[model samples]
Target: MDLGVKVDNLPAEAMMELAPRVEAAGLDEFWLIEDLGLAGGFTQVAAALERTRRVRVGLGIAPAAVRNVAYLAMEVATLARLHPGRFLMGVGHGMPEWLSQVGAHPASLMAALEEVTVALRRLLDGEQVAFHGSHVHLDRVRLAHPPAVPPPVSLGVRGPKGLDLARRIANGTILAEGSALDYIGDIASAAKGLDHRLTVFTWLSVDSDGDTARARLRDTIAEALVHPAMSVQLRSWYKADLTDAAIDALAVAGTPQDCAAALRRLADAGADAVILQPVRGAESAQIASLAEDIRPLLDAG
Candidate 1:
C-alpha cells in the first residue's frame, strides 16, 4: 500500500518549488489534478517528473470528453515511454458543469466513459484500434511507440454503477475526496471478482498539536460538508452529532499518531493507496509529516 500527497489548487510556481522537496522527503508519489480552470495535468506532471527522480507523478484524472481517446493514449504512452514506471494517468466523466461549459458533456455520460476506457486501453496496449461507440470514434489508430509496460488507466468516478463500470473496463478507480472507510468498503464489494486498484483522496492536516492540526483542516471540512455523498456517509458511518466542531473530526488531522491511526483504518478498509490532500497553506508540513512520521508508523505496525 502506497501513501501519497495531492498537489491541488496550488500555483505552478509553488508546485515546482515543492516538487524537489517532496522528492527529497521520500514520499511515494505526488498526484496532480486537471480541473476546469487550472494547470494542465499531464504538462504539470511532466515538469514534476523532470524535477524528481524517485517520486511517481499521477494525474488524478483527465476528463474523457475533453479530448480524443486516441490522442490521450498517445499522450499517456509518450509520457510512460519517457519515464517508464513513473507516471499514473487516469480519466473520467468530468464534472458536468465543466464539461457543459466546454461543450464536451455527452448526453449519456456512462456510455461515453465506457467507450473511452475501452478504446484507451486498447491503444495503450499497442493494438490497432478502430472503435465506433456511441460516444468515442476511432479510425484504425495505433501508437507508433507504445509503452513497453503500460501504466494502469484508472477511472475517476463515484457511485456504485460508476465503480462497476470502472471494474469492467479500467484497471483502477479514483474515489473523490472525502470518501470514508465504509464508502471504500462499498467500492471494494462492488469490484469483487475483478482485479481493480482503488485510490482514494482524504483531507489531511498534521501538526505537533492535535488542536492545531484540526484547526488547519477547517476549510477542507467545510468543503466536504456540501458534498451530498460525504454528508450521507458522515451521518451513517460515524453516527455523530454533526456539529461544526465535530465535522472537523472526519478528516485525517491531529498529531502524528492520530493521523497514522486514521491512515491505517483506511488501508484496512481496502484502499490500495491513500492520497492525502492537505488544506491550502498546510501542504508542505503535512507532506513532510506523511513521509517522516505517519508512514513510518504505518510501516512499523
Candidate 2:
C-alpha cells in the first residue's frame, strides 16, 4: 500500500525540484525510469536520494542489455551503501528497437536476463562471481566494497515466461503502465508463494474537477497506447475492445474519492505499491492530490 509517483521523462533539474516536494508532501516513494539516450538512472537516483531524507527513490528499471553485470552491480551497491533502506533497484529487458538501435539486444532474452539477474545478485551479495553465460561473462568478479545489506532488485517485465523468470530469480516484479485489473490479478496469482514486491504503474490524474481529471487522463492514455509494449499487450488481451478506446479501464482518474477507490481496487488485487504517472506537465499537481487527498484514504483503509 505504498504510494509513489513516477518521474517519467522529467529532466534532472525538475527532479531536483520535485524530489523535495514529493518528500515534503508525504509521499512514500519517488520512482524514476531510464530510457534510451535519456538521463542516466544511477545519476538521477543519486540526486533524488541526496535531495530527499525520508521518501525512497527507485529506478523503475535500467535496461540490462545496455549495462555490464559487474558495473551494474557496483552502481547498485554504491547507492545501497550510501542510502541504506531507501533505494529500489529495477533492471530488465529494454525496448527491442532501442536495444537493436544501440546493438545491445540479446538473441535470447530469457537467457540474457537469467544470466544477468543471477550474476548481479551474487555480486551484490558480496559473492565472487565467475559466470560465462551466452550474454554475460564475468571472470571471478567481486565488489571491492559491497553493502552490508543488498538492495532489492526488481525486474520490469511482462508475459508468462518473463514473469516466471522474475519470480524465480529476482527479488520483485514491476508491471508496466496500463495493466488492467484482471491482468494485475493474474500477475498477483503468479506472484503468490514468493516474497516478491509487486509494483505497478497505472496512468493517473486527479483533480477536484472530475472533467479536468478525466480529460487529462485520456490524453495520457492516448500517448501510452501508442507505445509498442502497451499496444501489443492491450491488443493481445483486449483485442477488439482495444479498437473501441478501452484505455479508460486501464487508467485511474477523476476526483480524489474516485482516484482513491481505484487505488484501493489495485491494492485489493495485490499491488504492493502503485506509482501514479501523470500526463506530461501534470506531475506536480497530481503528486499534490495524491499526497493531500488520495493518500489519506488509502492510509485509513
The TM-score leader among the candidates is: 2
> Per-residue lDDT of 217-293 in model 1, one digit per residue for the tens?
66556656666655544545344443534534466878889888888878777888888788688778777788888
Runs of candidate 2 exceeding 4 Å displacement: 223-228, 231-248
| TM-score (C-alpha, index-matched) for candidate 1 | 0.93
lDDT for model 1, please: 0.82
Q: Please give each candidate's TM-score.
A: 0.93, 0.94
Q: What is candidate 2's lDDT per residue for 169-248, written digit by digit as tens? A: 99999998878788888888987988999999888878788777787766556666666666534544443333323544
lDDT values for all models: 0.82, 0.84
What CA RMSD would you report for each candidate? 2.1, 2.1
- Give the per-residue Cα lDDT of candidate 2 at 155: 94
TM-score of 2: 0.94
